[model samples]
Target chain A: MDTIIQTVTSITWQQIVMMVIGGVLMYLGIKKNYEPTLLVPMGLGAILVNFPMTGVLTQTINGQKTEGVLDVLFNAGITTELFPLLIFIGIGAMIDFGPLLSNPFMLLFGAAAQFGIFFVVIVALLFGFNINEAASIGIIGAADGPTSIFVSNQLAPNLLGPIAIAAYSYMALVPIIQPMAIKLVTTKKERRIRMEYQAESVSKQTRILFPIIITIIAGLVAPVSLPLVGFLMFGNLLRECGVLDRLSNTAQNELVNIVSILLGLTISVKLTAGSFLKVQTLMIIAFGLVAFIMDSIGGVLFAKFLNLFRKTKINPMIGAAGISAFPMSSRVIQQMAQAEDKQNFVLMYAVGANVSGQIGSVIAGGLLLGFFS
Target chain B: MSAALTQGFELMLFGMGGVFAVLFLIYLVCIALNRIFSGKPKE
Candidate 1:
């Protein structure tokens, strides 16, 4: 009777708190439909990992110490960089760079958006985070989960959960965060400025050559980025080659789904209450917000600067697309534009810049890894 | 503290330089490709 009472009391407040947090994640997934694929599994994994006295973490078989199944999957997939790379392949296949190809200047917006990463890296270091940890945290600004994972794995694997959670959360909240940032930085006149959309149809030759050329150039320039850049370009090649429709379809759907499940649950293994409920995690979240805001500012400021020399003025609102939330950021920009003037503009240019942001963010991650390495 | 600041400054400079180099290369490649493939306005 005493042993049973002891067992009942052994389950602590912290574990109970973690369970509640897990339940919240589940509610968010099932009810709100916010990133359901990831949040659902992650919520389950969090509950499994936080259960106390389970001996799941310490269990051994045949006199040999072995990690629990989920922990093993986590370390093998995430720590080894398998999950992020596979996800990148799918992202590459899903992307159509036609819009960016038409508007080459969009690349500038992409590059500009990365200002948040560098700026926050410095700020984080001042806050006493080591260089490696700072790099990992700063990548949350990329508004990309895989890039954040890849960079954190290379630079600071321990911070993976916070970084990944922050990246995805901020990405989901982009619609809210970006408008305020845009409104703060750009006057209504600038938001109302309409740019002409040139309809440039790229040829098949250009489409096929792009992935190959970018792969070779980027791989040569930043050898450290080869695996990521190479695989991403390969996926794009599979897409553009027009010979592997089945493979492209698989990459976009089946392959991405499997990898996302593994990645989601594996990432949650780190959400054990002790590591996650901390001052460091809180600071990382705060700085992640800073990085995102700075990215918006950087992209918008760059666009404003360019307006000085150009006959054609760009809608500064489109600069928000530079944060690489992809179509979401572009959609937000379009809505904001429409809010000001019903027929003000279309979303194509913002979409182009958003795609450019994807490439730019990946390249920046590679460059950071190379510089630090 | 100063030493850390110096290192931070170097990293910042390197990061900025990389951004510039990358931006220039992307712009140049895009423009060059456009010029090469402009091709009689795609009738």
Candidate 2:
């Protein structure tokens, strides 16, 4: 009886704190609907991992300091680059490359948005982080969670938990972050600039060829990116191949849903209080914002440069969507457009650029690995 | 340290230039295709 009481009393304050944080995450998911798909599972996983002496988290190894279940899972899935690539496959299937095909110049916006990745990498390094860790932190600027996961897995596996959390958290907060950045950068008059939409319907053949051509080009140019890019493009191919409707649906909905649950919970298992509540984590969060802001700025500035040459001017606000947050960033641009000029335009152009960013970031990730490795 | 910074800077430039050139080549090909496949205007 005394042993049982002492065992109960042995539970630490840090575990209690993690339990509360888990509860808060659940409340945020159910009540506020802040990224419920990821947050709920992640919250539950955190709770499960934080339980005292569960023996679920511990493992016996021949020669190991302390093996935990999550540590093993992390090593297998995340450190090995399996989860992110699989997630990309689902993302690729969900994306419609038609908009991108209609306007290939949007690729420039995508490329430009990556300025933040390198920029923040330098800043992080200057702030005492080594090259790999800095690179992992900088990828948060891509406004892409999976790419961050993939890059960090390759570049800095130790930073994976914080990097993944920061990436996803910022992506969910894009609707809030991008608008303020857009508004601060562009005047009301510029924001209200109405542009005519060009009608360029892409053929099914073109759609089918796009993934193949892009894969060939990217694979040739940056072989390092093949895993992330290959998986993403393959997923897109599944979507665009016309006869593979069933596969595409499964990839987009069922596959993504299943993987998201597993991935989210797996990531959460790493979020122990000792690992999570750190000074570096705070800096990571701060720099992640900087990276995101820079990506937006890079896209916007590049669009503005294009405006100097092209007769058909694009709304600079749409450029902010070039960070690969997908429809969310595009939707923010659309909402901002509607607020400024209801009849101005929609976010199709931005969506095109947004998808292009998705591809471009993958390519960049590959190139970084190629160059660094 | 300065040398490392220079090397990093050069690396960054090379990357930026490399991707830019690739994007440019793709653009040129796209433009050329647009010109070739875009038939004469309907009478």
Candidate 3:
């Protein structure tokens, strides 16, 4: 009776607060339909682990040793970097890259959009995070959840929970965040600018060779990014190879879904009230928004800059799609363009930039690894 | 600037420069591949 009372009374306000946060995340996931698949599992995991002396995580029970399922999964998945890499395979399979291949110039926006990662690293440092922690937090700007997780896991494991939460939450808010950033930077004239989308047919051979050549280039330039670039390209190779249809389909569907569940839950292990309920967590969230906003501003400004030298002006709105939120960023840009003029169809160009952002985010992760590691 | 600040600036330069260089190379490669393999013009 006394033991039960002690256990019940030991529940601090911090744990209660964490449990409420978890509930809110679950509510957001189920009710609002914002990243339901990831948020639901992550929210549940956060709640489960916060229960005092819970066996959901590895803990010594009474006297005998015990290992929790979440801990086992975390050790086998996230720490090994297997989950994120596998998730990359699914992402790679889902991406067409055909649009990007047709309009390669969009790749510039992909590169430009990554500016926020480095910019925010400086900002994070100013906020008193060490260089490594700053880099990990700054990578939240990469806007690619797996890359953010992978980098934070490698560089600053202690901060992984907050960083991962910030990365995914901000990604879900891209529709809101990107448009505000775009409107702030661009004029009404710039917003209404139209782009001509020419449908260029890419050959089969080019499709097969793209993943291979890109892997080589990225590997050579930033050898540190090879695991990230390699796994992503490997998945793309499965997609483009034509002979691996079964594997590609599995990767795009079953493999991604399963890994996402595991990854989300495992990430929650780090969300204990001890680590999450802190001033730095709030600061990381704030910096993540800064990173995202800066990313949009950077891409739009670069596009506008390019217009200075070219006879044909590229619609600066496509630049905002260059963040690595994938189809979401692309879709947001397309919708924003349509809002200004229904006739403007920039989806293809936006997709091109979006795919390039995917690749750019991975490379940026690797570059940070190289510099900081 | 402080040492950490200096490192941060260097990282920004290298990171951005590296991304652009690699992606630009990819751009050029894609253009070349398209030209070589796109075949004869269709009527």
- DockQ of every candidate structure: 0.48, 0.28, 0.63
Give per-residue CA lDDT, model 2, range A1-373, as digits (tens): 9868865796678877887877887787778776788778778877877765554466333454466767677667777778778889899999997677677777777788777787887788777777778878988887788888888877877777788878877888888888877777788987887867676766666666667766777778777888887899899999988888899899899888888887888887667777777788889989999888888887787778888998878888767777888888888888889998888775788888888778767776776677678
Question: Model 1, stretches more than 4 Å misplaced?
Answer: A1-8, A55-66, B39-43
Model 3 misplaced stretches (Cα beyond 4 Å):
A1-4, B39-43
Q: How much does candidate 1 score in TM-score?
A: 0.94
The alpha-carbon lDDT assigned to residue A263 of candidate 3 equals: 91
- Which 10 consecutive positions of candidate 2 chain B have the poorest summed lDDT? B34-43
Candidate No. with top DockQ: 3
For candidate 3, what is the TM-score? Answer: 0.97
lDDT of each: 0.83, 0.77, 0.91
Q: Write candidate 1's Cα lDDT for B1-43 as tens digits.
A: 5676666667767765676577568667777777777623434
* Candidate 3 accuracy as lDDT: 0.91
DockQ of 3: 0.63
lDDT minimum window of 10 residues, candidate 3 chain A? A52-61
Q: Tens digits of per-residue lDDT for model 3 on A260-351?
A: 99998999999889989999999999999999999999999999999999998988988878899989999999999899988988899999
Docking quality level of the chain pair in candidate 2: acceptable
Higher-lDDT candidate among 1 and 2?
Answer: 1
Q: Rank by DockQ, descending?
A: 3, 1, 2
What are the iRMS values of all candidates?
Answer: 2.0, 3.4, 2.0
